[model samples]
Target: MGKPISGSAADNSDVSFGLTLMAIAVLIAPLIDIFSKLAIATIPSGQITAIRFTLQVLFILPVVALRGALFDLTWKKTALHALRGVLLVATMLSFITTLKVMEVADAIAIFFVEPIILTILGSIFLKETIGWRRYTACGVGFFGAMLVVQPSMQEVGLIALLPIVSAFTLAVFLLVTRLVAQSEDPWSMQFHAGIWGALFSAALLYFGEGTGSDVFDPVVPDALSLVYVLGVGVAATISGVLGVYAYRAAPASVLAPLQYLEIVSATLFGWLVFNDLPDALKWLGISIIITSGLYIIWREHRLNKTAGTAPVSPAI
Candidate 1:
């Protein structure tokens, strides 16, 4: 209520605060996979996906209502949101399926290919220019993903491809989200997407019932399973909101590199929760992937700084 902070002072404060939030978000992000992996033991991936989205909608709708943003959707915007949500559902379903058979760290390491894919897709669809160095980094990142995939393929068979599939789908989802991200608040955007995601996953579950598919068969959660399901929803909601706020407060270039911290959390949780640890070769791959990803983020930061372009929030 006194004087408001302004100028470079305010900017530095905001960046510092945003980074703190993003670090927390990165720490919390691994829990979603952990809970999903736990839930998948008892619940089918489809049902878990539906429950996750349903809980997100329930958690977000109240915020949207309070903000009076629920009635502002145009048809084009609604369709875009729906498309993004569908893509997200595909990504989650694939990821969770992989979680069923793979160690969480391995699955997450493979999925880390997303930033590379997002960069390529940005060049193709958004017409963003990428320098040769950044392109090389992307190539190296893919190689690192392959390193993780090779061992996982031997261990988990064809299921090793699921996280890669999820990465691609997630890249596309980010591309579409970029197109429609305008003046809408992040909470509102997430709320609408959650609604569509819940609907889409619900339909999939309905049609997929009795197929005897491990990924598609729906199961009624018992008391314990319900806790895991709720954990998934709660973790997702918190991390997602934190991500949005973090991006809003700082440049995506600054925040993007920090996201690699999730791999550390994934590794720790994998070891602690499931007693699963990546082998030396897999760890080497993870290091390479993290290096390439960090290089890409560094390059982006340099380019943005040199070009003096305003920072855009990345769709995580």
Candidate 2:
């Protein structure tokens, strides 16, 4: 047998740095979200979302202009994009509301149900076959999610449903993302989402204020807090870009469990930044979520291997 080959220095470096980038990006999400809550404390969730989308639009304007098809929306793609845009805005606003009210770790843990929902939807819509093992994994994951949220007894409230709504909306957004993947470029998708989000947020603001068209009001923000909001926007953008790169670099099986690392990061951020600690039940719940997610990924890889099929997307 030939001697085992060592990876080249560049290959090793690339792998190392790529993994680092993915991990850090996952961790950054909760931190950015915490800042979003601070921003939302002053501005309405609608306005916060509007500003975030506005910044994204401004940041991407030069590229969109160069691309030329910026506003060209094909009717079918426009409809799909609009649907996705509404889901995106709903997910953001609901999630922000959850963050404002709930513990960060709890919210993060509850949101872990997303992949489970996606798996079910994939089976239903994409005609993707899932084995009994994967189904069991999904079930276990959902149970763990409940443990994290611990919805039993009096803990359940009207607002408690927000995380579930956020997850469902986000799953729809992800489904649309899969559908639009072949047609939409990242910039165009972002542009569509931004414009739609801005429009919807403006409408919400108008309705909430009981006014006509004047939606946005520029108020002098508390200095440090304004800086924090900007920081959140920047961090979210960076994390979002990193997620795209991570998906490109690895299979979803490889990347999916790495996403569970966010729980660790969120736990730390919650404790240190917000003094929010996970309770025993919540911890137990998160453990379930982590195990289920890791198992689903492993089961997925095993299925692909046995069937001689390649992964659809790299781990994200």
Candidate 3:
């Protein structure tokens, strides 16, 4: 063999920086959840979701201009971005609505089914292969989600289904992100996604006018509630952008498991901010969901290792 490669040092550095970005992004991500949960107390979840994407667009517009990529999008990319925005809007609307009734930790726990959905979808749509063990884990993961949702169903009726919907939509959103990330830069992704999200949500708001639907009803929040709304937007912008760059910098298998840290931070914030804690049953369910998800991630890593493939990480 030739001399061992020294240039691998640069690759290691990139992965290190990527992992750091992922950690910071994951830890701070729950701030979005917290802020949305707080904001929706006075604002409709739909309006709150709209404001997030709107502010993300406003916040990132300057950066995109500074990078000279503000006009880089092709029409096809524009359509893809719009689809991503719609799926993401659906994800946020569903999850935040769940927060209107469910505890942050619990809602997030149920939302943890996303990884399983993503894996199964990847197998079906991307033609990625899945073994029986991973399939079994996915089944167990869904069962665990039901364990958490069963109680919420009793307490809040069908409202608990929203998180499952959130999980499915988010999985699809991730699939799109994976596809788009191959060609589009992460900042452009954010900018276009925000534009589409803002447009779609505004359309919903307009159509919701006079419908008397609680979820769609717009509200002029008080000063404090307005602060919460702003917090939601800012926190989302930060997490969303960081997450995009983090994925851009690293392989998916290495970065995927870091997301579990979000649940940990979310639990802490939920307890500290809202004094909400998962009961034993919810905790058991959260554990199972996490374990199953991690196993799936590990299997992905092994397959990638065997094939010497580096999978792309998805954006926010």
> TM-score per candidate, in order?
0.94, 0.84, 0.92
Best by lDDT: 1
Please say which candidate is ahead in TM-score: 2 or 3: 3
lDDT of 1 at 129: 92
Q: Please give, for residues 1-316, the per-residue lDDT of candidate 1 as tens digits.
A: 7887779889998899888988888888888999999999989998988899888888888788999988888889989999988998998999998898999989988888888888888888888999899899999999999999998999879999999898898889877876777656667778888888889999998888999878777877899999998998888878888887877898777677778788888889999999999999999999999898888878888777311111111122
What does candidate 2's lDDT look like per residue over 1-316, in tens digits?
Answer: 9766566765655556656767877878777677776676665566666667666666667777898859767888888888877887788778777776687778878877777777777789988899898799889988887776655323546565677678778877877877777776766777777777767776776666644222244344687767766766677677766776665565555566667777888788888878979778878888888788677777777777311111111111
lDDT of 3 by residue, 1-316 (tens): 7777576877888889888987887788778888888888878988988888888888888999999888888888888999999998898888888888888888888888888998888889988889999999999999999989998899899999999998888888878877888887778887888889889999999999778776887877889988887887777666767766666687868888888888899899999999999889888899999899888889878877311111111223
- The TM-score between candidate 1 and the true structure equals 0.94
The runs of at least 3 residues in candidate 2 whose Cα sits more than 4 Å from the true structure, single-residue gaps closed, are: 1-17, 66-72, 151-156, 211-225, 305-316
lDDT of the candidates, in the order given: 0.83, 0.69, 0.81
Task: Output the lDDT of residue 3, model 1.
Answer: 86
Evaluate model 1: give its lDDT.
0.83
lDDT (0-100) at residue 64 of candidate 3? 90
User: Which portions of model 3 miss their true places by more than 4 Å?
Assistant: 1-6, 305-316
State how far residue 245 of model 1 sits from its true place (Å).
1.5
How many residue pairs clash per model? 0, 7, 0
